[model samples]
Target: MSRDNPTSLEQRLSVHLQPLYPDEDPARMAQACLEAMELSPSATPVKPHANLWSERDTVVITYGDSIRREAEAPLQTLRQFCHDHLSDCISTLHILPFFPYSSDDGFSVMDYTTVNPALGNWDDIETLSAEFKIMGDLVINHCSSRSLWFDNFRQSIDPGASFFYCAPGDADTSMVVRPRTSPLLREVETPDGVKHVWCTFSHDQVDLNFENPDVLYEFIKIIRLYLEKGIRWFRMDAVAFVWKKLGTACINLPETHELIRLLRLLIEHKAPDAVIITETNIPNHENLTYFGNANEAHLIYNFSLPPLLLNTLITGNCTHLKSWLMTMPPAQFGTTYLNFVASHDGIGLRPTEGLLSEWEVDTMISTLQRFGAKVSCRTNAQGEPKPYEINISLWNALQGTAQHGPDTWQYARFMCAHAIMASLEGIPAFYIHSLIATENDYERIENTGHFRSINRHIWDADALSDALQDTGTHHHKVINGMRRLLEIRCKQPAFHPNATQFTLHLGESLFAFWRQSTDRRQSIFAIHNISDQPQSLNLSELNLVSTDQWTDLISEQHFEDRVAQLELAPYQYMWLTNL
Candidate 1:
């Protein structure tokens, strides 16, 4: 425990454990943690000098069961697809919730130790990890009521009864911030009697009680097991609601942050190169809190990006998006935003609460509805439901614009959106559905009775392959366009996660920004025309270097002569670098 040898695992564990378990013996707890760490599997080697946050780190967010075939395991097909198509462009595979689950896709985990048999086993995950960096969802907030832990709780077992939050049937829960209209306290039949348990998302997904140190220990053991299987990246699903307390909002609470910090310290202590990204789809101000004094999440999801991008493209105005971008919190020393346009979930509207006005949000919602998007709502503190997210593929969400139709024009607009996303000052991530230009799946939604099914599409491997291989299809075009942008982005030092960014106000319909690398050796000026018609840009007014020759990294086209004023085609973007 001396200063010179500060990294002794026991000392580090003592420091973290003492804060959470002050009354418990630190040595005993530390020894128990060491034993848990020792039981975890050994990690497979990745790259030697790999940095978790880098321009080279591009994540493809997909479900383990996203792709399927007639006779083979879905993961096998997925691994083969990544190798065949995405090996060159994507750096990490963020497979969302592959664990054995009862509901909510894979969020309602029934077992943390095993993968769903339909998706194959841990071997498939290891196979995928052997090729690319893998990210697994640590669904730490809640687990299925049917899980063994919950079953043990129902049987009044010691550790399992303490694993979840259970209160008297008449406990006051009026102050809880509700993300859904469902009752906060769900009645469950236990051996002792019927008790009310905390169910944040749904009745089946029981919230874990972190006030009990054993719950934290259980999650740590699960994470260690994942690390041993070569999962270097973990998306802490619904992490903001992990530690709940009555008479409070129960979201982003201090104790929750402490838990995150503890997990971060332990992960770093064990696997120095591992990453933990928090998935808190809340308001912009509250979401960033997960980066707890640089001790929590390695990356926080940029929830504002999806809605803001849609607003900019739909309204043909850059005011809201640009204003928010300018005021965005600067990326700290070891953390950055996980900039994404879409994911397995819908486009979150909560992040834009203060940024977009009520009228603006309504207008955007109506526009998306016209383009075949569905809106899901969440209850406010006063119990009135409001729009929380838009359920549709990002491509379709941007398709309602009058500037472009449903085919190539939509693809061009989609490419324009991603161009800005990649050029931003953070690691860019793409949802698998977005990469292939999928639209809202109305049939799936009707069949499953799941509102989010609109954005979650299951593809047949052979059919998907055919579409991707055919150059004329929209799927082929979108995938290729995204790949080209990602390839260009990964090679640019200015796109580093810790780069300094400055917003450039070109016009109402023109969105632009400049990224200067940490080393100052590279600077990139990214400009986008969100309008349906061509827009003229004046370089002099923006105080840019008035150069006669400026080259776009994406198109590789040289702009000569009239560099002071240039025209951008409808839904076009340029990553310009001065030579």
Candidate 2:
């Protein structure tokens, strides 16, 4: 069927829905899906654009209330901060789950249509969206147990009576995979009888039943509402575990991918430039599956980059990092990676399952623990507790190398990480805390009794402004360095998200890669010394053209001799380019 034909809209919908609902009438469900999207059957469909993102795209992830002031709303404060400081570099602001919630910060959403009054109103979000692209979380896998939908389910009422997944007490679930160590089933009392509800993350967050068509319709309406409110990017949180079967590993089911394709189709038909990003923090191979044939997700989180990059800097060796990079397949057109070193949550270990050795993982975890980091655990199939993620601030996590304790190379190491991320073949996202160089908030963990809270610190806007103004503090230095790197990155056509990338072999001490612009008009050799010791690089190794003038973009130094040896300081990086 031709996607450009308006009649094929319904057919495409049935193509995705039939596999999900084999016994149901697919045509009727397709009509209902169109109704939910507020689109008529004959409405003109917008064609998906080939280039939706570019080299200038950079994202900053933060909570709605991450920075607060005395009287003004946090969102307003955040808007002012971005306009004043981040206007030149950042292109998108991902406000993490700004909805009313019962637990798990904002992930356990109580309502999907309304913004959290405590943070701000939709007007605040709309105002911010005027200056930057806004990314919102769908939180598709689960909802707060205290939500109105759950309340309806408890009373066996309409809209949500059959909204949640229920299983028999004796159902086989030993093969299920989850990130949390919490019990899988939560016993809830309904008017009918006692029912065991599926709780993938925690008992307070009940998983939804996608097997029910109404549930899918409800989220389609929610997606439309977000689009009306200026949310250009939809981050599908914990989407991999949305479908389940009793005796199988409940993660990454085929039904889930079909649903993602359906959502992407609906979203793009309405707004051609809107993006759908999947947040699957599983193993690298499984995570890549979210981008099925360039139809499912517009972007997938580069989950392995965090642990691998962290290990490279901490261990001062790039053997594992280089190996992993060489094996990764470049994303197809209209799809790419969302690269980041840290976010609201901890650095997940699951992505390193196949990339790093057992001893290497254990050593990295121990070193992070020595630096005052906490480890969160999950239950294995055999019921053994295993480390799931390392909970620490990015600033503190890179205090020193594993071979040697804390050292004087912290600033250089920190800046080097961002340089590499910005130069990679994806849109680089930086957590707000990382840009400010915020340390782990042990006090927050003590207050909230959650390991993830260690990295989720609330900053006072006044104090943060003062800290950034003081040139002596690392906060000022880090933000300044980040802005400089991003400014340089946005000007280079070779840094486009879909540019050609090839891993360069410069031995384990130095990590290098070559990226050429899609038009082939520009080329950049991104080289970094991921060690504390100075390293020498022969210019001949880069194969620079003798006719063209070569220059280092970072230091703005012109290379006069093609064969001259260059010494890089500890944790130093260079963007060698020929314009």
Candidate 3:
């Protein structure tokens, strides 16, 4: 980037890609462009209320449910929940993967056409999509090995199939079996004489070869049809691994990026209403590449945020979050982040960029990885630490049924984490189960043959909801506390963007940031302490006149900014309104 600046994707690509792509054949180049289409095909209809993103502004509660196997069950709850928590503030609903998928938590989608029958019928999806203005997220990166696409690719490589990508004769067998860091690995097998085929996470899940133009075309068709049915967002699952060429890590490939661009183009040309949000579980710098100058995805899931939030809590720091903020380069002014702390998945150690110093990261992530490793815990009659895996010690540090931080420190810290999130640079999203504190650390659902559904649970949602509905329960206290922050955030104008300057007081574990809209019409500031101990701040350095008198939205509490320091309870947050 210094003296030899590469101007185009092809130019930047040629250096490392010449070995694979060879020359720029127009056909291949066109295919590459189609793969990352910025707009949908011209044949696609431009319908209303389909891709309303920034205009359809809402502070949504994004729940990463597997699918609509039984739509009536969750759909009903979703409708009700929407009306209650999100109806006014959130106009768009993101139901993650309502279609049937393979064991890898539905990323191995079997059929992209309809919601799996296990969840509900096609009619149910239509009903749900029609009943209320909601956004449905369809996973479109990989497919289950059992899918018709994979069947054709292996047992019957029919040219007219218009579905799967068949390797040229011996290519499938020719590819090597290796463990690649990236999720998409080329893996197929010769099962009892009939050679099966695919690029996949595992042998069970097969990746659709987008290299085949027909496969690309059919995938686009699926997007357009969903647009007709009111699906507003398509989350590209494992999207970075879409294009694979041996040797190099098959990730963030030029072709993969091109594919997203083409999809965006086709969507813009056809539907023009729905938004494409890429689910690249990478760091802020890498994730921003998904925007492709606003030609790829309209939004992206801030996958680093959850761990970033939790890390800030455990380490009593905001430096990493602030540093990442400075490095995040979004495509345009209007793009937003689908922000949340927890989703359907476990806390992934991703975005391993400059979040922490190399030594610190190695120490911290090694510690986290150790926490996740299999461990047998034993306790004495008095219930204290005994012989166990190192994971248990680290796990307990995160409030695993034992006192690690302080009394109610975990709960208070957790609540403040959410409050701070709700006040971050983007629309703060909450996983419904996390609100009620669904702390099911029951790890081994994978052993019951439901390997992928290990973390999946119906949840004791009714009890939590009812308790919150009742005024006196702890559930009410927690939910209302979260509700208060959310309700206040909705009224303020500053938190609408995803990129903003952060001001941190390192000693107090406090973070402050203001998102000033480009037009300067609105600005919002969030103040938070990640520490377990009570902290205070003196803003004489911040140059605010009488930092003493300011409007605090969270509890409707007023503060008088004076030369004297203002006190903050442990894990307290302030939503301040000012220029």
Candidate 4:
């Protein structure tokens, strides 16, 4: 083609995207942007993606009230503790969302840009952000509804501020919202007439209107603000409902994906290393969307693991656990799963809600129904169970915490979970209290009248003197066990995630799998007995030529001779390192 009718590379690429992002300046959009990465042709497809997390790389996470005041601040001490023990192995740290929210924990925010003075001043946050940044990884996600952007959307009386999406033009309608399913009904007074806004889970969390270009820009500014402070990861909080359309469940909309991709494109051009993590609390099926092209979230939470981990504890069995493990897909092979036993919010009854039989969910819902909890999604109309709040309390109370004794039935349940979470297939997270086996803050719930009690207790690393499995003080064992696992994992590069996992089922109680590297230098195999009774197994099935002298990383013990048979103690665990 002649120069006048040229189909040059620059023109071709420019014309390709000009129509879609018309608002983005074409000249600026042509500026260097990060290319989407796919597996290299030379790379093996079966290998697991390497870990962004390393035992020696340092991990920093923030939690509790960033707004907590008049309380002896533990953030400084926590930082010191992380530095003291981790030194180099763990590097990046993430703080929980402390943006101003409309109760229901801090999940729903009222203003995004403003720091909730209760946690600390913006100066304090900036100071801390600097401290963490210079030392290593510091990250915070753009907040929920509490953001100024959302506030503008929720801002009625001002038609000029179209930053947020309102429910039709009905800000004033009369409707009573029973916060809980109990008889205590609360009026949600709206403008004009008191009409109730669809809270979905709670009454206050009004969805934002991302359709407005202003809201998108505001979030971009929010992202830039945190990045300016040296935050490396931004946890995209509650992203499932970001963009909604009519006649749909108003979730995971096409616009939502477009919005996320656009944000990703922006981040790629500006902050290449900055990572986005999605905090969707749905099952694995729904949660997978967050990892959009591996470009969306650098990591996604392993939410499904918790309840199943709990179920394994109660039944002392691994069948269900094995099945779930099989369902895990390699959206992007080798990417890390942010595994956790507990988090800032309450434990959700997700993932498994789809897997479990209706009868099982019904039974649990009925139990909660008897307690005045109203169940939704996974529950029937016969029971008005408060699935949201009660699930949180019940999960925390029943775990192998110091709250209940060995005879309390919940004792073994807690212990069983301990073994599973520490050995699971992802980056395991330790809830502040869960680390020390802190008991459930039942009184906090009773006092707060909401889930904020989940965040009430202070974290004292040295306060616990109880045994790891000692009733409620189960934290010591769990921490050390996790530390030891990570330590062993770091010793071998093969554990770095370029490996494949092959699972083996030896009866219902014994669950075993190996994270095997191609070179076989760091093939790590773990066997767990989530059973009330001891399990004995044959070695022929596992391809182990020599079973003598296999080291138990957590207990620091060595077991000799499983050439013929291997025995697992009740609620036992084993991690074998390959030569």
Candidate 5:
């Protein structure tokens, strides 16, 4: 351990490994772990030089197979589109789980070392990385049962027998937080005998046993493989349930935080600019624990924002949202939140557990369901079904009294929602579907029998190009609107992740906030009318300044004198800054 900093990796690894291997030599274990961090002598990796956690950084989350062409690989078409269309607005591309998978839309990864052959090869990934920084998912919680590791485990090989968790039948294991209503112990036949292994997500996705140091070392190698391929940001998927203990909720455990910190240190040591963002979709208080003294995740997903934002729009109120934001703990200097409205998965409701009332949540779920959204449920400890997530495109989620199909009012509403998201005090991520302004693909859901497929639409390259060229189309309106917003957002230093946020409690039908730059030289006042009806903003009470020289950046309009009172059209927003 270093004499200057006792909390360094050497000291922390010793403490973290003691409980897992009580009798083993901690010094030897730490040495082995450090040895694994070194790259193979024959390998030649690219030099990484991407800076993360910047105000100009806006992430676009998509799948490698999202956009396709007739003969070209999907990833190739995606890269072409990024170069030809989105190169200016998007700074980072978050390709979701591009590895080979068996089910769950790449969540059940069969091979972590290779890309899905159907969606281009490593050449395509490297090409995209050359243009824009890439973020990849480290789905380390579980692996596909069809993977070679699982097969070898079934054969009871020396190294494979201890790769996954196969618990004893007599062991006491009752208290566990189940994300899905699935069986905890899955029965499988090994060469030795029948075994019941821990399957946290699904029977097809078996959880690995971290109790074995071999698994940890193997994951370290997998991460290095990604680093060699040019992944600057790593998203840890479903990591809350990574470490488990009997007679407990099996989430946010002490071991889990230590493991995250350990990974953070190793990655920072390897690539000084590399960033790790944890995707823990739990409650607010529990999720913040991942930023353990700035030694864990550089960013944690703002899971509460989606549902709470929905509640604000649906109920025509921002009271709860304001209260939640006021209570949100500020991030450390280098760590911030990954704010997003929609992603590959559904809009999570668990993050809004205490922020919203039961009736309020019921109303949100019911309203979205009326607008053609699907709801997924999880079983509580009392064996009752509870709403877990609302699966729908964000465009449809914000649709209210605008008629279902393509309409200007619907587009305006979507833009308003995005404006509020962009003004938030963190890096804003837009889902690929949301960026293109596409609606629910009911045909996809009917054909695949997967509800999440509604938002996960497989787009054609030529059709997307045609739609973008046509100004009247849905894709053009939403994509261009977002591009303009990002253009202005990137130029504003007040939108930095470390900016200070002050909630302005105007009323129920409006959500307003002021974001000031860290140096306090620049500020932006963002106001949004969440309701369908027009509302008036009282400027007399705001006391912004002595003069009325303010400019609306979104509309590019200047206000000189009549700033006493202003009216906001239905679902309208403005980003006002002193000129």
Candidate 6:
């Protein structure tokens, strides 16, 4: 069926809605959905551009208050900082959840429609959106227990009375999957009776009942409002556990995927340039399902990259990393991966289910612990505590190798990881802290009593500006190095998000890959020495064209002979390209 046809759209909506709402008339519900989106049945479908993203597109994820100044809203300060430093390299800004919230660092949303007054207002977001494509979180899975919706539920009022999911106290929920070890059901007193409301992440975050169509309608309106405010990229945060069934694992259910498709359909119809990104921190195979024949998420987070990359750099071996990369299928057009080494949260271990062995994971965890990283755990099906993620900044995580312990190659190793990420066939996102090479903030962890707080350090804007200007600090060096790489990457066609990528069989000590532009006009051999010892590679190994000149994009060095030997220092990487 043609997606642009009005009749086909209605049919598609009905097909997606039937499984989700078996009792309702799908046609009626579909019409109501169109009404909610303020779209007519015959409205022309706005076709998305052929190239939604490109090599020039890079993202930086940061909290609104990550860099703060006195007597000014944090969003304003963030805007000024990005304009001054990131405007040249970064094309998008992912301001993590700026909505009014009760807890969980803006995840537990209190009012989805209003911006957090502490940060700024919609005007500030609109202004920032004008300068850069803005990515906002659609915290669709749950809401704050202190929200008006939840409060109204307690009073048994309209809208909220049927908005929350509740089950009996003795209901069996042993098969449910969640990232938190918190109790699945939270006891609440309502006018009708005592309710055991579902809490996927924490007791303070009450899960919304998507079984009720009203909830879906509410989110559609929220998406519309965000588009009006110029937020083109929507990050569905913690979306895996949105739907639940009694006797099955709650995460990644088919109904959840259907909901995503419905949202994607509606969003694209409204704003052709809008992008829907799913934040599912699950196993590799299951995470791939979010692409859904190119009908679901426009971008899925490369969840396995962080832990695997950390292991590769720390152990000086790319056997596992190479194997995993070789197995990954390139993303289809209209969809790609969002690759990153760090974010506001920790390095999720769940995505490493089959990629890394138990011993390898334990060893990596222990090594991170030695570098002052904290481990967060979740309850498994057998009710055993297991490591969920490692909470530490990227700079601290790469302080040294597991064999040699902390060393002087921290700076080089850190840059090597990012360089490899940049050269991969995907859009690279940098966390604000990682760009500045911030260390673990144990002080924030102690203050908040949360392990993730270690990586969520808030910087004073003036102090950070001074550090960047000093040039002697690692902050200055890391940011400058990142900018240079991104600037160079943006000009290369081989680095396009959907470019062809093939893993190179260099060695365990060196990780390498070949990327060719879509039009076959440019080729790049991205190689990195992950070991602490110097490594050598014969230029002939790459089979470079004898007639065509080749150059290292990073150092601008010319390779005169195909058989010439190239020496790479420890933690060094090269982008050998033929333009």
Q: Spell out the clash pairs found in candidate 2.
A: none
lDDT of 4 at 66: 26
For each candidate, what TM-score against the reference?
Answer: 0.94, 0.98, 0.78, 0.75, 0.94, 0.98
* Clashes per model (N, Cα, C within 3 A): 0, 0, 41, 64, 0, 0
Lowest summed lDDT across 10 adjacent residues in model 6 is found at 1-10
User: RMSD to native for every prediction?
Assistant: 3.2, 1.5, 7.7, 7.3, 3.3, 1.5
Q: What C-alpha lDDT, on a 0 to 100 scale, does residue 321 get in candidate 6? A: 93
Instruction: Give the worst 10-residue stretch by lDDT in candidate 2.
Output: 1-10
> Which is the better candidate, 1 or 3, if ranked by lDDT?
1
Model 1 TM-score?
0.94
The predicted structure with the larger lDDT, 3 or 4, is 3
Q: Residues 524-551, candidate 5: write the lDDT tens digits.
A: 8889998777999877645476554778
Clashes of 4: 64
lDDT (CA) per prediction:
0.84, 0.93, 0.56, 0.52, 0.83, 0.93
**For candidate 4, lDDT tens digit of each residue in 1-579?**
232352433332234234435576533433322122221212222212334454233233446342222354444544555555444344455666555566655656666565555555455555555545321111122234444543433444442145434464334322322223432112333343432334444445554455554445456666666666566666776676665544455556665665565565455445555555676777678788777666456677888776666555545666877898888874365356777756556556655667766665454444434433333332223434435423343334443322122334343445446445545555555554554445556466677765546444654444433344354454655556445555655565434433566777677888778776546555556777776667897666665547334565656665455555777776667776545
- lDDT of predicted model 4: 0.52
Local accuracy of candidate 1 as per-residue lDDT tens digits, 82-180: 898889888999998888999999999999999899999999999999999999999988999989999999999975887998767787777777578
Candidate 6's displacement at residue 11, Å, is 2.4
Model 3, residue 447: displacement in angstroms? 5.6
> After superposition, which runs of candidate 5 have C-alpha atoms over 4 Å from their true positions?
1-9, 39-51, 170-173, 401-408, 547-549
